[model samples]
Structures are given as C-alpha cells and as structure tokens.
Target: MTIKAVRGKRDGPTLFVSAAIHGDEINGVEIVRRLLQHRALRSLRGTLVAIPIVNVHGFLNNSRYLPDGRDLNRSFPGSPKSSLAGRVAHSFFNNVVAQCEYGIDLHTGARHRGNLPQIRADLQDERTREMAEAFGAPVLLHAKTRDGSLREVASDQNIPILLYEAGEALRFDEVAIRVGVSGIINVMRQIGMLPPSRVKKPRRQPMVTDQSYWVRARVSGVLRALVPLGAFVKKGAILAVVSDPIGDTSGDTEICAQDEGIVIGRTYLPLVYEGDALFHIAKYKADIDEVLRHYHEFREEFEPDAYDPANHDPSEYDEDPPIAS
Candidate 1:
C-alpha cells in the first residue's frame, strides 16, 4: 500500500514476493526486480507486491544484521514500540503481507558460504507445503518454523510463505539468481495469478526432511571440502579434511558424514577455526542420487557449461521453454 512497497496490477489475489530481509542477503533483491519487470506478468490475474530491499541500511553495508545487531529475519511481526528493524517488520507484516493471499521469501547462505537453490518450508502445514511444491524450486526442505521468524509468524496467521534459499551472502551467483527469478514466476503461475510459464522443465518435488545439522570444524586449520552443495553423500563418508596452510602434521583433522543426504550449504572461506560450521546437510532416505541429478540438471538447462556462461546465454535460451507457470 505504501510507495516503498511497490505493487504491480490490481484486481486479483495479491501475492507478495519479498527479498533482502536479512540485509546482506541480496540475491533476492535482483530476483525480485527482474520479477517485477517480467513481461509475462502483463496478463497477471492478481496484484504482485515486490519489496526488493527490505533493510536498506544492512543491504548497503552488506551486513546480515540490522544496525542494532539484531537479525531482521528473526524480528518479524514485530512491534512499533520495538527497534528500527522490528518496526519495519511489524509495519510490513501488518500492512503489506497481511493483504496477500500467499507469500515467498528469498534468501541465501550466510557470509563465507554458498547454498544450492532450495526451498525451506514447514511442510507440516498443508498450505505452506502446497506453496513450497508450487514454488517448483530444484529442492525443498520441510523445516520447522523458528520463533519470531517471518515464516513462523506468517504461518501463525495461517498465511503460507515459502522461503527460498540459494547463492551466498554479500555476493551473487548468476545461476542462483536465475533459479530464484524463475522459481518465483513458477509460483505465480501455480496459483493461477499468472499464465502458464515457458522455461526449463519443472524439477521433481524435493523430499521432505525434518532434521538437519551443520557439520562444523573440530580442529582449526585450512579446510578442503570433499563435495559441493547438491552433492549426495552416503553415511560415514569423509566430508572434509582440515590441516595447516603449509601442510603441517595431520593429527586428527577430519569431518565425517553422520548420515546419508545431500549437501545444501557449504563454506567458501577455506580458513577456519575449531567449531566453525562448514556444511549444512539434510538427512533423507529418498533416492538422493535422483535429487542430486535434478539439482545439477536444473542449472545445466540454463547453461551449456557451468564453467562457461557464454554457452546457454539468456539471449540464446530465449525460446519457448517449459515454465512452471
């Protein structure tokens, strides 16, 4: 309803697509901007409200937390009597989000980390689960809602909000960005707010995993990961090894997998100390090999080679492709 919150087209179910709630998590900002400019939305049957940069201060500084050192994502549905971040969240929730029938929140891994494109939702909630499936992201996680988080607050209100995680903090990856923009459009199409999509074929629905753990470093040293995000690993596999930068004595410096699953997030900063989170893996018993294949194929469809962006340039892939919408 306000100027900062830009809405495109009126007269249909209002869908809110928000990004940069964590300030430094900006991949979503670009995704939302591109989403607003999509030509396909011309025939949209509903209002699309896009807030590209939610926390302008932290976004400018590439800081994940607000100036008050509070994580904005954890301050949702806040109060006017609270701090700056809280007030903004409260206002947006009470005014903009409250008016929407469905919502999508885009995000990325924290600083010094990278995440495979995936959706995190409370799959236990019927509506939330539906939207997560409709989102059509390469993978989906049925994570429980954290207290004070936007997803939790919205769920409490019975509003289904899908949280999309990908890329890395303070920077952007072209593939992750592409996946996010396309995913949002697919969601719009799924809800019948927009016409059917024409892009890469939709990926299979991701498995629902309730438990996840961040594999952290037990010894401080230079680290080398054995697999990247989206890679499948069997239980008891060697995930990573840490040693001195100059290859000093290797005295028990390794992290092993606790269960069979796929790597959803990993650290980029090789240098680390004891107790630093290195990998975020979700435990699942599904055909993870198929899940991994879908993850890579989803990205490959948009590129001729992951090493060469010139291969599947947007200009080249710009023909009619199967889109979720």
Candidate 2:
C-alpha cells in the first residue's frame, strides 16, 4: 500500500483517510487525490495520512478481491501469518490505521450499483455521531460494523471512524468526489485538525435513520426503475417493474416499497435475476416532504458546477481550498 502523510506545523489529532478497500471503488482514490491537493492542508493542524489504494493487488486487475480471491475489507486487523489478504490487512491496520485517532474509509456501491452520497457509521458513539453530522452527507445511516471489517476493528481499538459511500465502483462521479472532499474538510474542522469556519452558515442537517432494507427482484427479467435515487417513496409505492426482455408482460412483476422511506441506493444494470437486490430504502421518522426538501437542497449545494473553490470562502465550513485541474 502507498501512504502519503501531510503533517501540519502545529500538533493536533491524526486522521487517516483511506480508499479502495474494495479495489474497484476508485471514486475515493480521486477524492483522496483532490484532498491532498487542497491548499487548506498548508495550514492544517495535525497529520493527514492518505492511503488511496489499500488493496493494490485487486486494483491492479480492476477486481474487487485480492489475487487469493479473498476480500481485503473482510480481512481487517488480520494476523500476519494469515492469508495474503489477511497479511496485507494486518500491515495496513498496524502501520497505518492503528496510528490514527480518527479515520474516514471511502467506498462506492458494488459494481453495477450506485449509492446516494451518505455517511454510514455507528452513531451510538458521541464522537462518531458528531463527525458523521459534521461530514455533512445528505443521509447519515446508523450502521453496525461487520465482523471483520475495518470499522469494527478500529472501533474495537477506540477509534471513531466514518465510512462515506457514494457513486459506483470503477467510475468517477464528480458530485460524489466533490462531496467526499468537502465532507472530509468538514470533519477535520470538527475534530480540530483544521480551524472552524469564519463564515457560519446553517449546518446541513442530514436525515438520520437506523432502519433500512433492500427491495429485491421477485423474478429474473429486464428492470424498469420507476423511482430515482433520493426519491421519497410511500409504502406500497412501485419502485420498479420487471418483465421479460422479449416484451412479454404476462409474467411482469412490480417491485413495491415495503415501507415508507427514501431510496438511497439502486442497481444501474437493467438486467437482473430472481431475488436480486434492486433498491435500498432507509426509513426515517421525519416528515416526508421535509426529507425531500433536504435531499433537493443537498443536490443544489453539491452540483458539479456548484463547487468552485476559487469563488468559495477559504474559512467556510463547507468549502476547501482550490484543487488543481
């Protein structure tokens, strides 16, 4: 793994930003690159450790697993004597992740899937919750760490880590990249790694939800998505329709929402099989209209052309220094 460390003149907290734990998730790599180029680092308070590609073996081949066919993410805090994935995980966790007080693991949806920009972290921890809110994603998901995932191991060691999920694997979404960069700067300011904004705007309050589920396809067919990502759906709303690609509607199936929630993720591939996951919906207690308003506002705020560092105030909480073209 390649590591880049930028230390500020003043001592403060150490934050490690990692990407490509799933090698095909390349958006985070670009996010890390832009972050390292931001002029804000010139005045940063502590050290920023960036690992743009943690699963080098998988990245080299455009695959999501190591050469051993093991997922690097699920082998975290691994034993040195274990398999290749485990050993690599062990080295990275010890030499890099273990050395930081806080962390941000970047990710994207699985291949052929796309996720709405969101923050997934254990919100029960006060520090983690604060950082999640400060990250300023449109949605903050209260997710439990998996058995052998990086978040689990880091949390076991008392490190507050946030996982930012957006875009799709092996693809670069400009909006997602910009959001990732801006969110990191927000978290740094919140953690004292950077100064607080001189211009105080109303912080974007992300809709928080602990309940979410995947709507699966009932039959194999061509999928026609009726709802877009970030759409607020009502219980029983038709999310998509699955019918024979040959235009036979006789056995068509309408995938409907099981509960009222927001669509946070969905598959982009039109072809799917029986029981395939098609949409990810997160339930919230807030008003539906209010939630939609929040989503719309977030889109406007981070629209590709909306983020121009040159026109942005350097001390603003949501803005960072210019990144090179």
Candidate 3:
C-alpha cells in the first residue's frame, strides 16, 4: 500500500505504474524500483505514481492470494464493507488508480510457469494501442479485459491501461526486467510525459495476435520441453515430451502444437499433471520469418550487456539505495 509520487517541474499527464497484484509476481516490483531510479525523471513533464507491491499480505507470505483466500486482482473497485480483499481493492482503486490518466499493471506467469515479455491490452482502442506499441515488447496480445479486473474497471473510467506479463512468479528474469524498464520509459515518451530519445534506433513493431491457446500435457508425468520461449512451431509440431518419472517409457506422450504460432509461455517445472498447461501458443497471420526477425531485434535492443550506468547522462543516476530481492 506504499505509493511514491514523483512530480515534474511542469504539468502533464499523470501515469500510475503498479506491480504485484498477485503478490508472487515480483518482477514488476523490480521494474518499478528501477523505474524510480531512472535519471530521465529529472526532466519529466508530469507525474509518475509507483506502487511496487499491491498485495502486502500475499507478498509477506509469498502467496498469490490474501489471508482470506481471495484474489485481490478479481476484487477491483471493491467495497469497504466487503471482504478483506475487496476492501483493499476498494481503497487502492479509488485512492490510487482513480487519480491516474494512464496505467501500466505489471505481472508475471503463474507459479511454475514462465512467459515471454509481452503486452496484453485492449488493442481495439486507438490510444491503448498506441501505448502498447510504444512499450515495444516482443509480443502484443489483443486481450479482452476480464470482469472485475483492474483493467476492466480502469477502462470503464476511460483511463487507458496496459498490462505487462513476463518472466515467472517469485523469480527475476534479467531480460524481462530490463525490457520492462525500457518499455515504461518508451510509453512515457510516447504520452508526452518525457522527452523523446536522443539516440535513434529501430522502432519495435511487435508481433500482434488475438488468437492463442494452451498446449497441455496428455498424461501425468515429468515433462522434457523441446522448445524454448519465442520459438516458432508449425501445427502438429512436438513442443514437449511427457514421460513417466518412474522410468516407464510405454506411457511417454509427445505434446504437439495445435496451430502454427510462437511459444509465448510454458511451464518451467518439469513435474506436471495430466491436462497441465505446457506451452502457450499465440497464432500470428504475419510471416513467421518476419515475426522472428522482430523478436531478435527486440532482444538485441534490450540485451543486459548493452546497458551501462556510467555510459548514461549524469542526471540519469540516482542516489536511491537498491531494493533487496
């Protein structure tokens, strides 16, 4: 419930960046931390309100739900008279989200799963689509807002919002973190909260898709994945093989893709049960080679080794102590 507001010397739009609605998704926490330390804020035009942890109860226990066993995310625009999760959701939505003109909710894959860096938003809206493209993640998913979720409520208020999904729950992926930080800055620039970048680079045209489905394990066993995240696959291609953990090869089953698409998400843990989601495939009508080309360029642009604090403008450096992981 801690909120940090950084106001610029001039007036502009107010953008709120939130993380960890699920508590266990800690990657967004780091993204928000690094974003606050960015020197670019020195010349910022408007306001940046950062909420690093939204579910304090779940965060404390390393769980995804409140003590009442309720998901805070599904309790949006809640009532004070409702349950614990609803009350917290009410307070945060009204006091924080209600005041922002734009929002970016950060998240990660659920427990034991990993997601490629991607932007999920209602791309049908022109403003939201612009913001999503500006963020420049490898993939852009045209996701419909779920009922009772923050994005749905925010959209109802006419406040454009973007949801970023990456990495995995409770673990940090350096690439995902870096991409998150840079993507936020890109959105700020796009929305006129920050100046345009001086260094001209290739603009990111993320692969866009509205169709996706999960490839699930056919049998309960240990999984050996044959493909990595961002990998392209044809219809009926082998994505993984599930074998008996007790060394019974007779029951091995090869999980195959249901459609031609890219691997956007998958389970990281080898142990899985029957019908467990193994690979999240997003189908794209664009040429596969072109999609992959953009993906590679996105990776090259945000590679960790390419960034050095000392190489940045002196004003970009902040004295804030690093957050403990």
Residue 301, model 3: lDDT of 64
Per-residue CA lDDT of model 2 for 79-110, tens digit only, reads 99999999999999999999999999999999
Ten residues in sequence with the least summed lDDT for candidate 3: 316-325
How would you encode candidate 1's per-residue C-alpha lDDT over 37-104 as one tens digit per residue? 67777787867888888787888888988899898888988999999878988998998788888899
| Stretches of model 2 off by over 4 angstroms after superposition | 306-325
lDDT of 3 by residue, 46-152 (tens): 99999999998999999999999999889898999999999999999999999999999999999989999999999999999999999989899999988789999
Colliding pairs, model 3: 39-316
Q: C-alpha displacement of 266 in model 1, angstroms?
A: 0.8
Mark the 10 consecutive residues where model 1 has the least summed lDDT. 316-325
**TM-score for each candidate, following the candidate numbering:** 0.89, 0.93, 0.93
Model 3 clash tally? 1
How large an RMSD does model 1 have? 4.2
In model 1, how large is the Cα lDDT of residue 139?
69
Q: lDDT values of the candidates?
A: 0.79, 0.91, 0.91
Q: Residue 81 error for model 2, in Å?
A: 1.2
